[model samples]
Target: LSPSTGHRSIRTSSKPRPAKPCDPKSPCCRRSLTIDLDQSNNALDFVIYPRQFDIGECIGSCDTSGSSLQYTQAKNDQQKNKPHAAYNLVFLHHHGRNNNSLAATRNHRADKESSRCCSFSRTGGLELTYTTTVNGPIIKKYIPNMTVESCRCGLPATIQQV
Candidate 1:
């Protein structure tokens, strides 16, 4: 991926050989910025409160508010100001700055291009970390998966899972 842009995500690269095969001058080995948000949880990697999402999985999942919310900046915000979009998931950030709600609303209107994305889920759930010989569709397993059920089985009559 380009350091300035998070595009060109390699799901899986060649297996680590005894020697480095990449040439710095080639586009394949171009400079890349590895954003390790989940690992380091750095501030720059997160969106400041003034530019946070109002209601979404990214912020609410943290279950924080106020000064606590300040500390709860979303790592997903980094993607917001980018000139390009991520391969699969796109994160839209809500403006949380101190200003009139009406103005803020207009500025960050949903119809705005910047507001468009896959979702506000900070995790984006792109498991771009797996290292193996596998690549492409096979690397999809890295992304987080969720299971849902409408009702419980073999339980009391009134008991329901959903």
Candidate 2:
């Protein structure tokens, strides 16, 4: 994505690819994903600015070896309630045990059973102005969480059987 305008790139001849595949030890990260709204195969009739834009995607394998500390910086003016029509995020959490009891080990094994996936940690959006049909009325829409800002290895469920 463009650092200046926060807009994505226009279409190019060749698409970008990751240098190498991610492994279990690799950190979950973001990769550029350029989307062409006007691709020949697309069934839409709108002309979008930043014709080709990067929404990005998550890549890498989730580390299942040992746990580590994660710190999050809170926004000073974070909103208590998000704006209307915002995307809802579901986060899976691991229940860590302090003791290494047999039951704890069993729970840990169960936790491992639930594999983690590379997922979005933070996200933003872009405003898209398009017409429903060719020469149709122009509409401007702000899509929330349409772009991946950061990524992490996370569980996919809100509840886990311990």
Candidate 3:
């Protein structure tokens, strides 16, 4: 009997692979940054930087039981000792109230109410209104061969691809 020639011969092909570095400089490496302004459980302004490929722009008003505004920037700089490629700008305004009573002992109950109302008016009825815009500048030094795009917040978003 002929030695097992029944097994089919396997054939393989070798193709040359493209040469390229995996970590080419790109916006994909940059992190999204955000800034927020809030008051009495309400958001006044929320803006995202590098708006392209991200959500950006928020405007509203809130009453002040108490209010707070905060700003933060985040980005991934692959190279050590390099500053983040994004920045955030914000402007905020707070309102002040007036007091009606200054008497020391004109009916203790009435005095208490007056003080309470004064303090309450200071922050209990705060109104915050604003408009927000985002601008993103290309960090050419980071990605030499690509252009950055501008993006706005909403459905059916658009992005300029490099």
Candidate 4:
């Protein structure tokens, strides 16, 4: 009878489990932006030319000479007297894992504030491209036309993206 008890134990097998659910707040499940820079097969020299005069109220200035630089007209009459130029500006933000962290949340707010203020005070123009992702599925893509204007007043009169 003891031997029968040992041999009569029940055994059952279960199907393999499915993949674990993705966390809504997980950084691993988030989307990211990819930037690709294509330079022709040529060795290029790089240089940053400083502004000879104050470039409105903004901290940066137009790169006077470069392969990737350009100039747009001032948005207003007051800005026409200043030197006009354009350059690529790269903004890098490092947000840690916590979605509620200050860097993650406040970066866009700060950029909005700066853009509003600079639009009012600056004479020169700038165009930027970058990527950001949030939990929401909403995606926004903006490609502004080449702007040429006097920066004193009014938005870019000739705003058209090409």
Best by TM-score: 2
Which model scores highest in lDDT?
2
Query: How many residue pairs collide in each prediction?
Result: 0, 0, 2, 10
- Per residue, candidate 1 scores C-alpha lDDT tens digits across 16-83 of 11222334332221112233334444543332221221111111122122233322342245335332
Q: What tens digits encode model 4's per-residue C-alpha lDDT throughout 1-162? A: 248566533212111112233344331111111121232122211111111112122212222231211123222321442232222111101111224666646765643322221122112222233233334333333323212212222211222212
**C-alpha lDDT (0 to 100) for residue 38 of candidate 1:** 46
Over 4 Å off in model 2, which ranges?
1-26, 65-109, 112-114, 157-162
Q: What is the C-alpha RMSD of each candidate to the true structure, in Å?
A: 20.3, 14.0, 26.3, 25.0
lDDT of each candidate versus the true structure: 0.26, 0.49, 0.22, 0.24
Instruction: Report the candidate with higher lDDT, 1 versus 3.
Output: 1
Cα displacement (Å) at residue 35, model 2: 0.9
Candidate 2: 10-residue stretch with minimal lDDT:
69-78
Error of 3 at 10 (Å): 52
- What value does the lDDT take at residue 122 in candidate 1? 20
Supply candidate 4's per-residue lDDT for 62: 29
lDDT of 2: 0.49
Q: Could you give candidate 3's per-residue lDDT for residues 19-138 as a string of tens digits?
A: 122233321222222322322123423322222222122111121222212111111111321222221111111111122244533544543322221010000111122234344432
